[model samples]
Target: MAYTKHIPKKRILCRELQFVLVLLLGWLAPHSLCAQRVSIGLYDTCSIQLLRVCPLSAGYKLLLNGKFVEVEKGTELNFSSRGRMLICERAGNEYEPCEHIALVHTDPNAQFELSLLRPQAETRTYDGNLSLFVDFGRIMCLNLVDQEAYIAGVALAEVGAKAKPELYKAQALLIRTYLMGNRAKHLEEGFNLCDQVHCQAYKGSASKYPYIRQATQQTAGMVVVDAEGNLITSVFHANCGGQTASARDVWMTETPYLQSVKDPYCRRSRGANWKKTVSLNDWKRFLQSKGVSTERINNTGYLYRSETREGMYELPGGIAVPFRDLREYFNLKSAWFNVAVDGGEVLLSGRGYGHGIGMCQEGAIRMAEEGKTAAEIINFYFRGARIVKQQ
Candidate 1:
C-alpha cells in the first residue's frame, strides 16, 4: 500500500493511515483542528479504558460530523471530539509507544500510605492558623490586618512546612473563604463587598466542611525563592522526620530555603521513610576513590570536591557528591541499594522511602488526634521557628 510513500521517508504505516482519516474528517468539520497541546504524554482515565491521542506531530484522532477520524504523521488535521479530556503529561514521549506506554493502568491497591507518601507531594496543608495558602487557580489574594496577616503567614508556614500536598491544597482553599478585596494587586479588581470581615468568615470545624468550598476556589500561585533572591525551586514536605533541613543540610549551600525553618507552620513529622545512617569507611577504600593524597582522608574528613562544576563534593574515599543529587537522594522512599566491592559479592540493601523531614504523616495525624493544632505540631518539630506573617 504505497498510497503515500514519497514525503517524510520515515513515516510509519500507522502514521500514514492516520493522515488520510483526518483529511476526510476535516472536510466535514473544518474548525476542529486548531488547538493541540503539543507532544504531551496524554492519557485518558475518564472511562478508565479508552485512550484518545493527539501526538502533536504524528497522529490525531477526532470525531467530526458524527464520524470518527484520524490524521496521520506529517499531515495537518481538522476534527472535533465530544468526549472530555482527562490528563496530559508535561513531558513528551521520546519513543512512540515505549515499553511503559498505556491508555490507563489502574492500580488495585492505591490506599494512602503515610510513610510512603511525601507531604510535599500532597500539595496542600493546614497549620491550624486562620489563612490558607491555596496553590490552585493561579490567583491568590488576601487582605488582612497586621495581626490576621501575621496569623495567615504563620499558618501558611506551619501548615506548608508540616502538611502534605493534598492537605496544603485543601487548607489553602479553606482560607480563601475568609478573604475580602484580596491583596493589593487583586484590590484593583472590583468586588461586590468592601473591607471588613463581611466577605470572610471564621468557620470552626475539623472536617473543614464550611470553609472548603471557598478555599478551593481558584487563586494565584506563589513562587519560592533562594537567599540570593533567585526563585528557589520548591522542595515541599509534610514531615521531616522530626527535623527539617537547613538549606545547607540538603542543598549543601546557603539557599533561601534555609530560612524556611522560620515558618511556624512548617514542620515535618517524626517518622520518616529515609533516615541518616553512619558511614565510616577505611582510608584504603576512601582514598582510592578520591584520586587524591590518601593522607587527607586519614587526617581530616575533607573529601575531594570538584572545583570546576560547583556543588560537586567528594567524600574522603572520593565518592562523587552533587548537592542537588543529594537533596533528591536523601529524600527517597523505598529504594534499592547495591554496593559493588572489587572482589566481594555485591551487597544489596532495601530501605524505606522519603526525605526525613518534619511532621511525619503518621506521627502528625496521630498528634492531630491528640488535640495538637497545626501550630503546636509544627513548633515541636521545626525548632526555634516562630509563626509569623509574610509582612
Candidate 2:
C-alpha cells in the first residue's frame, strides 16, 4: 500500500524547507500547496445521461470541444450524451452536438450546482469547475475541486454537521490521509476518486456548515503516521460496540497501530446494539454447508456466545466458524454477536454497526463532546500513531 512508504526525516525536512521557500517566493499559493486540486467522478455508481449545470460564481466560461463560449453567472445549461457525443443546450436554445464540454470558472472561489436530470436525482452544489464527456454510452461528469473542499464535504457526509469541531478535525485528518494514500485509485478512469463509499462518500461542498470547512482547513496537510513515519490506514466505522476489532482479526493483516482496543464511549450511542432471529434449521444448515458434521447439528451445537469480539464461533467437536462469514451470510450488522438457540429459532444479539474495525465514529463524537482534542481522539483509537503535517 502507498501508506507504508517510509520516508526519511532528512528528506522530509528538506521537502518542507523547499515548500516554505516556494511559498515565500510567490511561486505557489498557500492553499495550493496544502490543499491541492483533485479530480473526482460524480455519481459514479449511476448511469448518468442528462445533467444540468448552473454556475454559482462569476467569470464562468463554457468550453465546447476546446472552444471557449462566454457564459454568465447563474446561467443554466443542460448536457446530454447521444451515441458517444456530448449535446449541450441553454434554456430556449437549440441543442448543440459536441465531443466534450467543460465549465471553467476564472474565479478562485468557483462553485456550481449540478442536477442529474435524466436519472431525476437530487441537485447538489459543489465548489469547483465541472467537466463533461461521453463515455461507455453515458455522460461522465467530473468535478475539479480543491482537496480541502473535498475533505470538508466528505467529513460532513461521513459524520454529519452536528458533530463537534474536534470530531470534524479528526475526521478531516483521516480523510486527507486516506486521500493521500489512495489518490491513484481511479487514475485509469481519469479521476482521483469517486463520490461513493468505495472511496469516500462526498455529497458535494460543505457550504452549510462553516465549521466543517474551518476544521478541515485547520487540519490541512496533516495525516496520521505510524512509528516508521509512514501514513497509517485511517479506517473507521459507525460504532465499535464497546470494543474495536483488530486489523488482524478483521482483515487478516497485522497492523501495529490497528490493534483491538476497549472503547466504552459509544456503548450508549446509536448503532451500538441490534438483534435478529433466524430458524435453527437454517443456522444448522449454514454450519453444515461450512463442513460441520451432521452429528454436531444438535441444539447445543448451534449455540454460541461472544462476550468480547472474537474471530471465530467455536462449535462442538472443535469445529469453528468465522464470525465474518456468518455476518455476511446472515446479513448481520457486525461480527460481534451472541448466538442462542431458543426452541426452533436462533436469536442473534449483535453489537456495533459496521465491520467493527479501526476508529468508531460515535465513540469519537462522544470523546469530542467530552472535550477531547482531535489528537487525543485519534491517538486513543489508533494506538501509537502520530498526527503530522504532510511533507
Candidate 3:
C-alpha cells in the first residue's frame, strides 16, 4: 500500500483530528488522556475474513474456559464463528468459544502472530495480548497492547518503515498526541481505537521496524500541547505542496495552532505536483450544477480564488465553492489546485496532498535529513505547540 497517499479528504481528516475535552475532574484523571494499554480493534468480522493465529514466543497461552492452555509455536489456529459463538479449528477438531479466547503473552517484550490469512493480505505480526470474541454476531479481534507500541505501529504504517530517526520520532510524537487527544473516542465500542484509516491506520504491529520502535521509545509518553496546556489536535499529511492550510480554511472551524504556514521543505518532495484535465463544457456543467451561471462569465481565464480564503474558487454571481468539494467530486489529490482553460479541456494543476494541515511528512523527512530535531520540526509546523510528557 502507498503509505504517502493515505490522505483521505478534508472531512475525513477533520473527523480524525477533532478534540472534545472538558476541563473537569475526568480531564484530571490519569487514564483520561494517558493510558499504557490500548485496545485496538483488529477485525470486525473475522469469519468472513480469513485469519490465522500463532505463537511467536515460548510462554504464549490461550485462555479457554478460565484455563490457560499453552499455545505452541508451530500450531496454527484458524478462526470461524457462528451466531454469537466463536470457533477455533486446529488440525481438524473445532473448539467452541469458551466465552472468549484470550491469547496471553507472558513476556512483555516477546512478539506473537495475528496473521490475516486471506489472499493478498498483509501478514502482520503483533506484540501483547489478543482477545477474540463474537461481537454483534461477528468475530472481532481486539489487541490489548502498550501505548508506545501502538504508536510505533501507527508511525510505521502511516509514514512507511524506512524514514529517518528524527522523522520517525516526529511522527511518533504526533501520533502520541493524537492518541491521547482521541483516547476515549470508542469508549462505548470496547476499544480505544480501531485498526483502520478512520482511526489512524494501525496495522497490528511494529516488530518489522526497529528504527520506528526506537523512535517511539525515545519519545515515550510525550505529547504536543497548546499554550493553554490543553491537548491539541494532531493532524498530519503526506505533503503540503509549497504551503500548509489553516484549520479554518479546510474544516471551517479555526484552530489557532493550525494556522497557515509557508513550507519549503516539501515543495520538491514526492507527490508534490499533479495535473487533471476535464472538457471545458463538462467543467462548466459541473459548476452550473452547483447553482453557478456561466453564460455571461468569460470562459478563457483562470478560476478566481479568494485571497482571504485559501482554497475557495470564486465564480460568477459572487458564488464561492470550496476546492475540497470539487476535489471530492472529481477525485483529485488535494483541494490546493489552479484551474486553467486549455483548447478543449480545463486543466487543474494541483499541489500537495491530503488536507495540507499540521506536519507535512515529506517536509518532516527532509527536515530530519537536514539534522533538525523532532521537537524543532513539530514546533515549526504547529504554531505555539510544545511537546510535554503526560503526568
Candidate 4:
C-alpha cells in the first residue's frame, strides 16, 4: 500500500532547506477472515410489511448483513432460501442474491487515492486534489525486521499505543478489549493461520509474520484506562496539552485519565510546528527569564535537556501545562516525559518531530539505512513487550 511522499531535494537559492513531508496511510485487508452465513431481518416481524413477503417494497433493498448483496440496480432480486445467507445493500438500493457477492469491507486489488499536502500546517481540512496528513515518520522505523515496507502502518497504529500507560490506567484494558472483540475459537485458529497485522499482528498469540510477530512480542502487556478506574476501548487525540483529561473530563465523564494528556510535549510540538524554533538569542532570553542557566545554552541555540516551548507555565505541583488550551479545553497540567538532548541549534537541534518516544521514525530510517529489520527495530523501544508465535 502507498504511504508518504518524499519532497524533491531541489537546491533552493539558499542552503537552508525547507519542505513539507506528506503522510498517507493505506488500509490492508484482514488476514484469514472466517465467513458467516445468517438471515437478515428485512422488515420487523411485527411490522405491517411482514404480512406481505412478496418482496419488501418497490425500491427498498435488503442486506443479509453488512456486505454487498450484488443485486443489480432497478432489477428484481431472486432469493428462494431465506434461511441460507445474509442480505445487505444500500438502504434505498436493490439487493440481489447473496451468492453473487465475492467480498466485503475491502479489496486489495482495487485502486487508491493520493493527495498533495503542506506540513508545519494550519487547519485540518483537506482540499482533496492532493491533501495529506502530517505525522512523525521517525518512530516507525525504530525496530524493523528483515526490511519490511510497512513503515506507514507502523506509524498509524502506534500513535495510540505510545500515548497510553501515561494516558490511561492498567494494561489489562487493552487485552480485554481485543480479546473480547475476537474471542471465538474459529477466529483464534484463523489467527494462527494468517501472516499479517490485519489478523493478530503481535509476537506471541497467533501472528507468524516476523515484523508483526515482533511487535506483538514486545508490547505483550500494555493498556490504557480512565479516571473512574475503568478500561477504555476508544482512543482519542490532540495531545491533551500535557495534563491528560479523564474520559468524563475531556469527553465529559469522570473516568480516570481516560481522555487526557499529562505532559507538555503537545505545546512543544505545537511551538515547533506553529512558531519557528526559538532563536538562539531569544532562547537565551527565555531560559534566563525562567531561572535556568544561560550556560545551559552552550554554543548551541538551546539548553541541553531543558524546556524550549514558548507556551507553558508551572502549576501548583510544579507541573508544566500548555497555555494554548486554557479556553477551548481545561488548562493542562502534566509533567510529561522525553529523551534528554545535550546541545544543538534550537531551530536545527530540535529539528525532527514527535515526543522522542520509544521508536524514533527518523532514527529508524537511519537504522534501516544501516541494515536493521523492523522487528528488531520495534523490540528496541518496547522493553517488556514480546514477540511470540500465536499458535
Candidate 5:
C-alpha cells in the first residue's frame, strides 16, 4: 500500500491535447502518398538480359501473373520474346505468351537494381521494381517508379547532372509537366511512357545527384497549364539560337502557349552554332527528290531563307522548302540554319541544336544561372501558361 501511495490513478488524457497530437502526427506523415508511380516501357527489343538483379531490401517476392515464382536475390535473368511469350531462366520457367512478371517486397518502399548485360556495352543501373513481359512479339521491361523520382532521372538524362540548382529545378518542372500532359501517351503499348526520346528520354535513376532530387522534390506535382487549367505541352529543346519557334512554325499546330520569342541567352551557350557541308549537287538532288526544281540552283549562289516564315527556305524555281525537311534529309543539327555555296559544297551554318520550338534549354540554364527561378523561367518561355499544382 505504501509503495503505491504516490501513484495517482492515471489522469484522463485531455481531449484537446489528444486531438492536437493526432493533427501533428497526420501533418508529419510522409508526403509520398501524394506521389504517383509511372509505368515506363524500357528496352523495347526482341530480347534482353539482366546481368544481375538484386533486391536492395529483404523479402522481395517474384510473381508471374499473380503466381509466385521461386527466386533468390542476386539472380541473373534473361528475357526473350518467343512468339509473344517471355522465356526466363528463373525456375526453369517457360512463361505463357504475354505473361507479366511482377516484383514485390515486404517493405512498401523497397527498391531493386536491374543491370543490362547485352547490346549495350556499358552497364546502367536502374531503380524501382522491374516488370518483365512480352508485348506484340517483343520483349519489354516496365519500370514502375515514383513520378517525382522519374522526373529527376529524365531531367538529368535529357540535360545533364552538372547543371545549376535553379536550372535543375526548371528542368524538373518541365519534365513533370510533360509527363502529366502526356501521361496516357502509350496506353496502347501497355505502359504509360517509353524510355526513349519519343516520350522523355529517361535513362535511369538520378539518385546520385542530390541537386536533381532537391529540384524534383521542391517542384513536386507542379505542372505548366493554360489559363483554363489544362496541362500545357511543356516542350523543350537543346538550344534555340537567338529566337525560339512557335508551335505553328515547327509543327503546323497553333498553340497559344507555344509562341515564338527572342532568346539571347542561348546564343552564347553550348550547341549554339554548327556547320555541315554537303555537296551542292547532293543538296540539289535531295531537293529535287522532294519535287523541287533544282535546275535554276547553282553551287555558288545564295539560297534565300524564308522572309515570312521562320525556318522555311525559298529555293530557286519557286520551291519553298521548310528547314525541318532539310534538317531531316541532311541530318542537320537544327532548323535554324542558312545555306551558302563554298567550294562546290553547300555550307549549312546552323544556329541551334534542335527544333527550336518551345523552351530553349540552354537559354533556361543561363537564366537560372542569372538567378531566375523555375516559375520565372517557365513564364518567360511558355506564354499564357501558369504553374499549377496537381491534387
Candidate 6:
C-alpha cells in the first residue's frame, strides 16, 4: 500500500479468503483445547431417597426449579424426593420443591461433600458441580466434573493410593480412554457414566493422593488408540497370574492389541494365586446344568488341569464348557485355574484375581517400581497400541 502497488481483484479476493480462514481457525482453536466435562451418576447403584450436600469451596450458584439463588460456603442443604419433585431444605428454611436442582460453583476449582442420609452411605467429596433430580421414586445425584478430575478419581479408586506416579499415570490413561470410548453408556440414564465397577469406580476427588493428580495432569488429553486411531477398550484387572488374556479368549471378540502376553511382574504379587474348594456334588451339578452328562462327570472328565489359561474346559464326550461360565458359577477369583476332585470337595487352585484381560495392576505397579515409564507399562500390556492426545 505504501508503494501504491496495483493488485488484481482475484488476487485481493484470495488474500481476503486466506485472512478469513486464519481467523476462523484461530477462533476454533480455543474450543478444541477446552477441557471435556462429564456428568457422572454418583451412588448410581443405590436407591438414595435423601441426600445431604455441603459446599467445601467459597460458594455455589443454586439453580432450584427455574430460579437461581446464591448459596454461601459451608451451607448444608438436605434434599429429599417427593414423587417427581425434589425438596431441598437449608438450615431451617424449606424452599419450594424443584423438579431439578443444580449446584454450580463460580470457581472452576470448587469442591463439595455429598452423603446419603436415607440409605446410609459413606460420605464422599467431589470436585466441580452437583445436579440432583427425582427419577423412579428415588433421588438421582449427578456430578458434573471436569474429565481429568474424574479420571484421577477413578484411578485412585481403581488402583488405590499406594502406587507410583508412573503407575498412576498408566491407570489414568486407561481410565480416560475408557471414558472417551464409553461416554454414551448411560446416556439414556441421564448421565455420561456411573460411579460403579460396571463403568469405573469413582469414590470421589483424588485430593488425598497428590501424586495421582500430578500423574493425571502429566498425561492430560491422552488416550490409548489402536493402529487405526480407534480408542482401545483399555480394560484392566487386579492381577494376571503369570500372563494376560486375549480378548478373543475371554470376551469372544478378537482384538489385535488385547492379545495374550506373558507377564513376569505380577507373579509374586498378592493377587497372583488363590485356592477355593467347593462341594464336588455342587460342581457336578453345575456342569450338569451346562449340559455335561452324568457319565462324563463321573468319569472325571470334569476334573481339568490348566497349566496355561484355557477358554474352554473339555469333557469326555467332546462337550466343552466356557471357563467364564465356570468362573461365574463357582464365584471363582479367575477362570485360569486347575480343577481336581479331592475327597468330597472340588479343589480349585486359581491364578490371578480378575478376568485377566489387558493391563494387570500388580504388574504395572511392579514395572513402575522398576522405573518403567507409563508409556512402557501401557505398551507392554496392550501390544502395538499408541498413546495419543485426545482430539
Off by over 4 Å in 6: 1-33, 296-299
What is the full ranking by TM-score, best candidate first?
2, 6, 3, 5, 1, 4
TM-score on alpha carbons, each prediction: 0.30, 0.90, 0.87, 0.27, 0.82, 0.89
- Decide which is better by lDDT, 3 or 4: 3
lDDT of 4 by residue, 281-361 (tens): 554455455565666334532223323333343322344333233212221222122212234334322222322223333
lDDT of residue 291 for candidate 4: 62
lDDT tens readout by residue for model 5, 1-391: 0000121112232454334322322312223474467777775432454333556655677766557665566655555556655566654555553455666554335666666665443445566666765444444577777777788889888778877888888788788877776766665555666776767787878887877888778988777789888888878888888888888876899899888888978889878889999998788888888887666666544564432226567765666777778887887887877777877788877787887777899999899888988888888889879887885
lDDT of 2 by residue, 63-122 (tens): 775578888888999888779788888986845687667787755368889999989899
Q: Lowest summed lDDT over 10 consecutive residues: which window, candidate 4?
A: 138-147
Tens-digit lDDT track for model 6 on 62-138?
Answer: 88755789888889999998888899999988899887788987554699999899999988999998887777787
Instruction: Determine the C-alpha RMSD for candidate 6 after optimal superposition of all C-alphas.
Output: 13.1
Please rank every candidate by lDDT, starting with the best: 6, 2, 3, 5, 1, 4
Give stretches of model 2 more than 4 Å off.
1-35
Shift in Å, residue 330, candidate 3: 1.5
Expressed as tens digits, the lDDT of each residue in 141-231 for candidate 3 is: 7787777888889988888877889998988888888887776666555556677666778886787777789877899878889999988
Q: Which one wins by TM-score: 1 or 2? A: 2
Give me candidate 6's TM-score against the actual structure: 0.89
Candidate 4 similarity to native, TM-score: 0.27
Clashes of each: 58, 0, 0, 59, 0, 0
- Distance from true location, Cα of 220 in model 6, Å: 1.0
> Total backbone clashes of model 6?
0
Better of 1 and 4 by lDDT: 1
